[model samples]
Target: MSDPAALLRAYDHQLRDEAETPSAVAVERLGPLRLATFRGGRGFITYSTLDEDGRPATQESVLALVDGALAHYTASPDIHRVEWKTRGHDHAPGLHEALVGHGFVPDEPESVMVGEAALLAVDVELPAGVVVRQVTDEDDVRAMCAMQAEVFGDTPEFAAEILLQVLHRLRTRDDMEMWVAEADGTIVSAGRLEPVAGSEFAGIWGGATLPEWRGKGIYRALTAARARSALRHGKRYINSDSTEFSRPILERSGLVKVSTTTPYEWRRDT
Candidate 1:
């Protein structure tokens, strides 16, 4: 039997701790959680484990930690939104309820998929006239961001926020990469590859494809390109928090759905 729990534990130990925010304004520890404050009044919460053995987390301790984490961010005048990230494979009993009780609204859950990079680096047949390549210039970045916002059905402001962050990272980090697929002089799909610092894992993120271009292997081809890039960077594994539409594709590419993660958001009262 494939041990999903074992894989999750290894991911938590190896990747979670090593992937700290590069530009966080403030970061504090509250029990197992790392509470981080970032630019634009954003806050993030993540933890290695609530219970490492996959047993149920103690309710009292869990509640206390949640309260403490909330207090830490709530006391900050700069924080306007906080996201508490939770994983399904964790022993986080009452965690959802506790977060909701504290005014946190849950977002949709996503599959946590992990696998060898070699499996995803296979060459895929691209549609006629479709081409994929890495992009860095401002104009290319803006075009990629616009296409992604349209594909994901998000507002332009959302893409603008992402553009700012990606641009900042581009200036500071060489491990980040952006790829886009184009046909007939227009972008059809886009994605990001983020190689975690000090770890063997790289993440494939922000994968979006125009509805008209679905099922033509464009997304898979983009993934293959990112996986090949990861290998060149010495990363052996690829991980992603996948939506339902992309989960099967990653599974077919040999990534295992070891767990699910949800984000609970707390927006400060204006």
Candidate 2:
């Protein structure tokens, strides 16, 4: 009775609409392709179905949309780099060559992963003198942000200034919180809980553990912390855009890879 494709499409739409800064965060139509910008210094490109682009729209319209959108971002001052998050299952045509022509470099395609929160909720073992807890202290948040920056290979380091800005925004609305795993006062792993209020879902993001501390179950433990937090907020489903390193773990925990996402990055300079 459930169509995975339809369900995935619906979930995608819900995430787009429920996000706080949903406009630029998910998809912003500049002309043809939707240009997406997020808080993490990341950019995204996507589009709605082009059924009405013409009397009988073809993939050419989609290609033009991408070209026009890139030109739009390259002209903006705020955007440093942009990525076109492409879905493998969508009715996209000529997207690959078009993106390459526009200077959008493709990253490895990752599973468009989905899972139930309950499946991931479980107690995990931390090393001796290690514990997982909610963290909001300036130092702890900054440390966590920096760890994330390292994991993503982003510069300008996710610093205290950026964390403060995020906190300032969180103070007015209480839909998100930060968590970290500490081993002997050192932040070993960290993540965030994002509640999509009025929806049956919450997102677990930024699950990272130091390389030396990994394979010892720290990632799973951090996920448990976030999943429990999600349940407390009345969220039933959990979602993440997972990479290869984490996909197997999620799959073992009962998540279904609903779709696939490929990011096409375009620069502002060329």
Best by TM-score: 1
User: In angstroms, how far off is 205's CA in candidate 2?
Assistant: 1.5
**Which tens-of-lDDT digit does each residue in 236-265 have in candidate 1?**
888999999899999998888988989899
Looking at candidate 1, the ten consecutive residues that score lowest on lDDT are 16-25
Clashes of each: 0, 1
Q: Give the alpha-carbon lDDT of every model.
A: 0.85, 0.72
My TM-score estimates for the predictions, one after another, are 0.92, 0.84
* Cα lDDT of model 2 by residue, 45-146, tens digit: 655444444533357876767767777777667776777777777666787888898888999888866667888899887778889899767677778888
Candidate 1: Cα lDDT at 172 = 76
Error of 2 at 42 (Å): 5.7
